[model samples]
Target: AQSVAQPEDQVNVAEGNPLTVKCTYSVSGNPYLFWYVQYPNRGLQFLLKYITGDNLVKGSYGFEAEFNKSQTSFHLKKPSALVSDSALYFCAVRITGGFKTIFGAGTRLFVKA
Candidate 1:
């Protein structure tokens, strides 16, 4: 079985400070990792993906994630947060032979002005 866990229910940060939303996963075979962002009543937007190769993957809105195979973790990060960056984030994983993607419960990021 493949699954993802976002340990935090919410994260709060100042508009100019850095922010991180942690995520971990479990899978049977080679894992396809993805990060998505969602606004109120809107569909998720693809932030980034880590299929293979580089451990460090960058994405939209100045966001990036590090793929740690040993730890089975992929944590999203940003150098500086913005008020507009406040939204819901979901981490997902996909294994072979399946069209379904497993998503985390989601984490709400609150960037204060």
Candidate 2:
């Protein structure tokens, strides 16, 4: 029983535009999606992972993510966005064999300049 749904809690991009942060998931097998970024107090930062092959997966700094396995969606892309890319974004799902990693209650990105 793995689950994640980040139905936008906050998102406002302006610095350079082109930024999307949204995710949805529910898993039983063949699902190990992940994307994380947190700054304020600093803890989570492992942005980008889909576990298998390119469904458009790239990470670190100039992030990217698009692994839509029939609408199980995993969307988090950044083409040009940096006001230090205002932080706090999380969408994760990894409980396949069980070591639990299910998180999505954060989506705060306000990159203004």
Candidate 3:
């Protein structure tokens, strides 16, 4: 069974500072990594993904993620934080040919001005 984990319950950063939401995974084979952000009363929005190719994957809203095979990690990162970026973030993982995607509990990001 594939599983995703977000160790942090919440992350806080000052506006303009960098932010990161940690994610780790356990899978049988190669897996796809995804990051999604959910705003209050809004559906989860796709942020970025790591399918293959480069280790660094970039996605929407100025967000990017790094895929580390050895560490089994795909941590989301943003160089500059914005108050508007505050939201609940989720990390997901899916096997190469699997239909079901495992999602983390979610990490709330707080960008303070």
Clashes of each: 0, 0, 0
Please give, for residues 2-96, the per-residue lDDT of candidate 2 as tens digits: 78999999999898889999999998788888898989977998977988878999999889999988999999999899999898899998855
User: What TM-score would you give candidate 2 relative to the actual structure?
Assistant: 0.33
Q: Compare candidates 1 and 2 on lDDT and give the better one.
A: 1
Off by over 4 Å in 3: none
lDDT of each: 0.96, 0.89, 0.95
Tell me the TM-score of each prediction against the true structure: 0.97, 0.33, 0.98
List the candidate 2 regions with Cα displacement exceeding 4 Å: 1-4, 15-20, 32-51, 55-63, 66-75, 81-113
Worst-scoring 10-residue span by lDDT in model 2:
93-102
Q: For residue 71, what is the lDDT in candidate 1?
A: 99
User: CA shift at 62, candidate 2, in angstroms?
Assistant: 11
lDDT tens digits, residue span 44-67, model 1: 999999998999999998999999
Candidate 1 segments whose C-alpha is farther than 4 A from its true place? none
Clash pairs detected, candidate 2: none
lDDT of 3 by residue, 3-92 (tens): 899999999999999999999999999999999999999999999999999999989989999999999999999999999999999999
